[model samples]
Target: MKLFAVIGDPIVHSKSPRMHNNALQVLMKNAVYTRYHLKDNAKLKEIVNFFNGVNITIPFKEEAFKIADFKDKSVVDIGCANTLLNKNNKIYAYNTDYLGFLKAIDNFCNIKNALILGAGGTARALAFALKIKNIQVTISNRSSNRLKHLSDYECCLYSNLNLHKKFDLVINTTSAGLHDTDLPCNEIILKNIFSNARYAFDVIYGKNTPFLNLAKKYNLKTKDGLDMLLWQGVFAFELFLDCKKTKEIFKAMEIALKLP
Candidate 1:
């Protein structure tokens, strides 16, 4: 069977196997998807040698970008790599977060101005993607300290949102709302933000996060992380699957994700 996996430190929480393997089975493809809890970057070379392809997360995204023998310039510009494919003994990197992210937004209405929460690697790629589309980005977080190291784009704080300034889109790239106790923002501010947003996108796919639920309550179009996850996984799988088997793999993924 062809093999694939997603790598991260806290990989145990990943549902990628269920998602990807299900897709493979639905498409009648012979493949297995698993998760790897990599201890550190020291074993990156070994890891790459073993897997035909891998989905990277968090800390390893940057490392993947460095070790990749080939990469999309947009991903390179962001200094991160979430998807890696090994072909001809060379590593190829790409950033599906932006593409997947944009796709998730397509599920909603138009997005012109956006407010992104967080300033991490994914945030950087997302911001650049937005820039390419010529959309104005208003970044928000608890602190602006990290902004000094990132872009000089307009930055705001969750506590200081202009009650009058409305945005076309709101995205949550932060780890907030990942756990049961996590919420995207304070109740009052979240209400105000969603009141004006046409759509909301939360990068967390595990469940219906507070960020998404709140948007729903406000009657704004909202999407979970699943579509983004599926699109990115499908894109990453293409790096490994041949022309004939490619179609089957993604077909299977659709079935898996839609399964009850």
Candidate 2:
């Protein structure tokens, strides 16, 4: 069986193995997916020496981006990699975060105004994904200094979430809600945002987040990162299959990972 894994510093909580293994079983593919925790990002190269390829996650996405011999422009824009492919003798990296993010918002008809809650690599991918659709995206983060590279866009402090303007979409890209708790931001801010927001998205998926709960309380359409997680796996599986029985494979994955 071909070997694959998701690599990161803190990977114990990842459901990627369950998701991917389900997909493999549904598609009858000969593959094994696992998770590996690395103390250092530099160990990625050494790990790649054995495995065929691996998915990347937080804290290491940028490091994986740096080491990839070739990078898709989409991954370059995100400054990270969520999917890595070992092609020929070169390691290539791509970011399916946008693919998953795009799939999350594909059903939302109008998304002209949106609020993004972090300034990390996933946030960058989401911002560009929004920009691609010609939507205006405003980002709020703790320290606006590290976001100098994103200065060209409208950016502000997280405290300014109470501004009078109403957003059509609000996405929580921070790790804040992963532990089943909301960010330190006031509850009133979420009430204010989701009151007018049409949809909400949180990138943390192991469970329904406090952020999503607050959005749902306002009757706003909300989605966790789970579908994005599943679809990205579908996207990567297509690459892994190299066009062999693509539709059959994806349909099976979709059924196996069907969302409630």
Candidate 3:
């Protein structure tokens, strides 16, 4: 069987395996999907070469991009990758996260400006996507040091988020709400920002994270990462099978995620 897996540090909670495995069953593809809780970046290339295809998450996307033999234009533009395919012992990288984020936020609201709360690989993907849509983007991270990497966009420290002036959407691209009951920024900061925001999105799924909860308290439309995960897995599955008939596979994966 062709092997595939998603690699990340805190990967135990990932639904990529279940989502892709179900899609494989629907497509009758001879493939298996699993998760690798990878803690060390040094082992990424070794683990990826062992698999036919792999999905990357969190801190490893940039590392994956750096080691790939080839990268899709989107991956190159974003400087990160979330999907990799091994062909003839060479690795090719792609950024399904951009496509997935676009699909997830479709028709949600008229976003004139967006505040992205992180400075990691995912943030890069999101910033790129939002800019493509012509939505003004501002990035905020806990520290100012990482802001330098995102020089194209206006960036600031978490404590200085109010300097942005205005925002229509607020996105939590950090892992602060994952595996813990913590907000990405201080409660007062979030409250001030959400007071005028129309929507809030958290890249951490599978639970009502404190970030989303705070958005709810402010009466903002809230979204989790579940839809993004499903769509990105669908795009990755298409790459894995080299097929385009994704309607059935998409339905199957959606049903699998809804199972009790």
Per-residue lDDT tens digits for candidate 1, residues 1-260, read 87888999888877778777776666666878889889889887689779888899876888888899998997777778898888899988888788777666665555678888887878877887787878888888788776665664787777777756788888888888878667767878878878888888888885888788888999988777877787777777665564445457556776776766
**Deviation of model 2 at 186, angstroms:** 3.0
Off by over 4 Å in 2: 244-247, 254-260
Q: What TM-score, to 2 decimals, does candidate 1 have?
A: 0.86
What are the candidates' C-alpha RMSDs?
Answer: 2.6, 2.4, 1.3
What is the lDDT ranking, best to worst?
A: 3, 2, 1
How many clashes does each candidate structure show, in the order listed? 3, 0, 0
Summarize candidate 2's per-residue lDDT along 1-260 as a digit string, tens digits. 88888988789987777767777887677988899988887788788656777888887887888889999998777678888888787888988788878987789887898999888888888898898889999988888774787864798887866567889999988888867666635677777877888899988875778998888889999888877777777777776656455456556656655554
Name the candidate, 1 or 3, with the larger lDDT value. Answer: 3
Off by over 4 Å in 1: 25-31, 159-163, 242-248
lDDT winner among the candidates?
3
Clashes in predicted model 1: 3
TM-score of candidate 2 versus the correct structure, residues matched by position: 0.90
Q: Residue 101, candidate 3: how far off, in angstroms?
A: 1.0
| lDDT per model vs. reference | 0.79, 0.80, 0.90
Compute the lDDT for candidate 1. 0.79
